[model samples]
Target: MASALNSKIHAPGNCPGSKADARGGAGWRMDCDPEMHVKMCKKIAQLTKVIYALNTRQDETEAGMEALREAHQEELQQAVAETEARLLQAQGRVGEEEALRQRIQALESALELQKQLTQEALAQSASCRLETQERELRVEAEHAERVLTLSKEMLELKADYEKRLRHLSGHEAPRWDRLTKEGPEPKAEPGCGPEMREVLLEVERLRAENQQLSKDYARKAEELQATYERENEAVRQAMQQSVSEALWQWQEKETDLRKNFQAQEAALQAQVRKLEGDLEHRGRKISDLKKYAQKLKDRIQDLDVQLKEARQENSELKSTAKKLGEKLAIAKDKLMLQECHVTQKTGDMKTERVSENEVLRKENNLEACSLHPQQDQNFAKECPCTKGGTDTQTKKEACIETEYMKQKYEEDLRKIKHQTEEEKKHLKDQLMKRLEDLVKKHTVEIKSVRSSVEAERKRLQKEVEAQLEEVKKKSENEIKQLEEEKAALSVKLQNSLLEVLRLEEFIQQNKACPPRGDEKPQELDYQHCNILETQ
Candidate 1:
């Protein structure tokens, strides 16, 4: 196009060159007709107008490029901010995840501790039950032994009484038999003798003695039966009372164990409630963190969309700048052609016009050279000097802003990390403190409960021992009294036997005297004499 425009402007027979000037080149003239000069002037005027329009378009392109560069920088800053925000959100999520894990671990540990405590408490309770059962068994065994001893003593006393009764009966039976065999010699007499009357009196005394012995035997048997019944009743009452006391003690111990278990349950429930509340709080935090992360993702998406728009606009501005550069080159060529035509008409403007043309040509050459490279360079370096200056300045500002944002992001990340660390430590401390307090409290409670249980058990043991001793002493005293009663009854039996022997000897003496042949054997009524029925 420049070659065609040059051909049109410097064509033959159109204008006079400097070499063809009249008067030795001091003045120059256009060899063209006046009409052609007018046409050329009009064309120069039109070219000036086109150049002016191109200059205006170039200014507009520069302004647009500058604006686009500023917009791009702002978009870059926004993109950096979005990236930083996303990074921060990610970091926050990581921290939250870690915190949640820690909390879960803490809760798990607490649960394990609680389980262990519960197991220990159960073991302690089980051991306590075993001890109580053993004690009860021992008490029952002791009671059985005591009862057996009392029964044995009673049986031995009964056997002894039976042996003594049999011995006394055997000795009296032979004596009675001998007395019966020795009958009195019969002598017939019409009148009664004094001896016969005396013999009759002795027989009457013996009959009275037999009746008295029978009455005494009956009374002693009734007394012995009554004493035995009373001793049995006393023993039964003592056993019943001991059993009742043992039962009451067992009930009290059971109640104490139930109360302790209830207390432990309440404490565990409170701890569970606290743990549930902590879990709920953590859940809320997790939910909030999720919401924040979602918001950050949305913001990043928005920033991505905005960045694409900025890039699209930047490309459009580059294309517009390239088109404007082409238009400027064309306008520059037209202006150069206009100046050549004007300089050919006016001799005085030759050197100035040539210099101006040379400068315009150089600019055209540079623009043409940079045109292809502009596609790969993003038009930043290959752009017009003024445009390049704006691009470089804006780029530097964007870089500074990005670096600042990076530094700020790093600082924020550091702060967040520090805060998260502190939070973790604080939470851990609180958990540890709570766990320690719970452990201490549980230990104290267990100790107190165990001490109380031991004390109660000991007290119950002492009380039972004292009751057993009292029962023993009472039983012994009753046994001693029974033995004394038996001895007194035995003495009475011996006296009765001696009286019988004396009566028998008197009868034999009277028989020997024969009462003067028993002048008259008075009719003795023997029907009134009867032996007593003994048990």
Candidate 2:
């Protein structure tokens, strides 16, 4: 049993006992019957073989089945993987289709939206055009209204102006008074005015545009326009009214002012006329005075010339008187000489008479001598005489002697007396005749010389008077002309003063106020300006 136990233990299939290789002996001693052991070993071997076969078969079948399961699992995995990949591909295709559909839908939606937007834009543009047209109409209406209002106002103003003009036709004190002259002259408008119609048209246009907008829209769109319209109208009306009122007042005042100015100008013109007349009268008076002065000067010159002539005449007369005196002296001397000659001739005649007488006496004496030649008369002569003869003879002798002596004495005395008487008579006759002739000749010559000298003096005096009169007239006329020129200059200076005052008033209109003085501005050129060109 032990061996069976060992054999069984050593057996490959089933073992009951100890194992073969355990104790060691057959190489450990067959511990059981050998045949039995052999049979057992054989049976064990058979069983081992059968077990090996069966195990091999079972292992192979398990391997095959495992391989098949693995293959099937692999197949299943491949199928599952293929299905998953196909399903994923299908899902991807579906997603791609969905994405494409979304893109197409988006494009269609965008096109529809674009069409709608175009339609909306057209509608909005039409609405805006309508609104703009409405605004234009409203603006035109406002402009018409403004024009009508302005026309009405102008008509009223014209009517008022005509009424005032008619009222001015009635009589006042003198149409104007002097007190108005002391007031200021009215001024023209300050600056050059623009066309009122143009400004009104612009304002109407803006107002129309403003009215076109809705109140809410105006707040958004025409806020500036609305404000401008209100302000423009207010300013226009205020300024227009101010200008119109000023114009009205000015027009009303202008009539009286014009009348006053006309009156003042008329008075001034009258004064100027009077002054001119006075000036003319003065000039005439001066001319007459100059003429009278000329006459006086002429008279004085004539007197002077006459005086000089008289002086010359006096000298000539003195010379004539001297000549006459000399002639008288010469006549007197000639008369004296003639008297002497007459006296000498008379004496010579007397001497001749005396000689004749002496001749007679000499004859008588000769006769006596003849008779008494030889007679000696001392004694009485004894003669044969008759008695009468002797006595007569004696007496005759005595008488002869005595008569001779007496005759001689008488001749001498007569001769002397005769010369003296002849001289006296001749002197008296010659003196009287010479005096008469000399007086007559001298009177004629002096009268002729005096007349000629007086005539020459008168002619020279007349020429000198004419020259003096011309000089005096010229001097008087120059003085009168100078006076007239001075008067004219004074009038011109007054005109200049008026012109300066007007100019000052005009300039002061631009200033803060007017100055009351006649001051003027002055400028001085301190530098000598020259332009020199150099080439």
Candidate 3:
């Protein structure tokens, strides 16, 4: 505004010379001291020169201020651009993290799928093993049945041999007496029957022992099957522990990835904050320039009024000089009072212009002073000339614009913060859901496996118990047959002993009557060998 103040003096059309000459002729010159007029002219000349210098200085100051304002505005635009770029970069990073999260989720899903497949495969394998074991048990049971049939055949054969022996014992006594009484000694080994009986008994005992061994082998096979089940349980536990460990490691890796993403986001936020600070300072500078321009416009208008008054005064001075030429020395005394009035008017105009300039300068300074606190700190550092460059309302507008931008940026930051939090929560929820699914799947699989294992164990145990009962029944039947055969053998030995004792007593009674030895031998001598029941 100060730079615009040029040629702004107002003068009235009634000048000192013109007014003095109008009332009296040369009295205009006679009343005013000639020396004072010359002094005033010299003063005006010096003051004009000073005003020109001041205008030059003001122009330079204004130019410099304009350049500074433009530079600050450019800086503000650059800062805003940088801030926007930073925000975009942060958004990019957030997008990248989201993508990574998606990929991680996909990976986790794939792993879960693989785990499920593996579990299914394991179950199938376990079923196959059970089938194989069942086949083995069936084969063992078949072998045991074959051995039992063989034992039964051997027992029937022993019973047949005992019946044949009893038939021979019943018929042999009459044949032995005839052979001894009618023939010269027909000597054949008489112990062949006993030898054959001993050999048959040994064969039956061997068959019984073989059947017992088969029973023992079947019992051992059942024990081995139980041991196999225990081993399978231990192996299954080992696999479960390893699977849990791997899942735990994956969770640790997931936590590490999340922490890294958060750290990068925090660094980006710091960069954004620095840019926002610089943008606010530049906005304040631009506002200052606007107010300065307004001040200059007002000053220019005031100068136009000053110019119009100056032109009218110059015309009046010319008219006064013409009137003074007409009324020379006669009006000098009256003109002195008119000269006094003109000087008073000139002084008043100059003083008023000076005061107005001072007031405008003060207002500009006050306006410039109304800067943001943050800008003021920087202005104190970089721009001392900021004081008197603009008006108060211009600074106020800057403050408002800065506040609005700050609020907008803060709101955006808040929105971004909210989105980030929500995304994190969403990701967490997804992770938790996946974890729950894994747990549920694992739990279900474990329960199914456990039930299957239990079912299989129970089925195998029942089969083994059934086999054991079958073997017991077979053993009891064999034992009963063996006891019956033992009792019959003991009865045959007792009958043979009683026949030998009776024969000995008869022989002793006949020994005292040895006279008829040559007479036909009685058949009774061979009777001892004729016991068919003993056979």
Tens digit of lDDT per residue, candidate 2, span 121-173?
Answer: 43553464345335434543554354344334444544664464455433332
TM-score of 1: 0.34
lDDT of 2 at 395: 40
Q: Write the per-residue lDDT of candidate 1 for residues 1-535, one digit (tens) a residue.
A: 4345545655554445645432222222233233333443554455456556646665675676567567656866876786687678768867876776686567546645654654464455446444544553454344334434433443454455446556655655664465467556444344635555665565567556545644554454345334533543453344445444444554454455446545544554555455446545544554454455445444554455445544544454455445545644554454455445454534434454456557756876786686775553553444456444654553355345434543653464466448646855775686567557755765675566556655655665566457446645654564465356445534643454454354346334434543211121121111001111110
Instruction: Write candidate 3's Cα lDDT for 150-244 as tens digits.
Output: 43544454456556556655556565565568577645457655654564575567557556644554454344434433443343344334433
Error of 3 at 52 (Å): 3.6
Q: Per-residue lDDT for 176 in model 3?
A: 51
The runs of at least 3 residues in candidate 1 whose Cα sits more than 4 Å from the true structure, single-residue gaps closed, are: 1-42, 176-535
- Give the CA lDDT, 0 to 100, for residue 471 in model 2: 43
Please tell me which predicted candidate would have the highest TM-score against the true structure. Answer: 1
Q: Estimate each model's TM-score.
A: 0.34, 0.24, 0.31
Residue 354 deviation, candidate 1, in Å?
A: 34
lDDT of each: 0.49, 0.45, 0.46
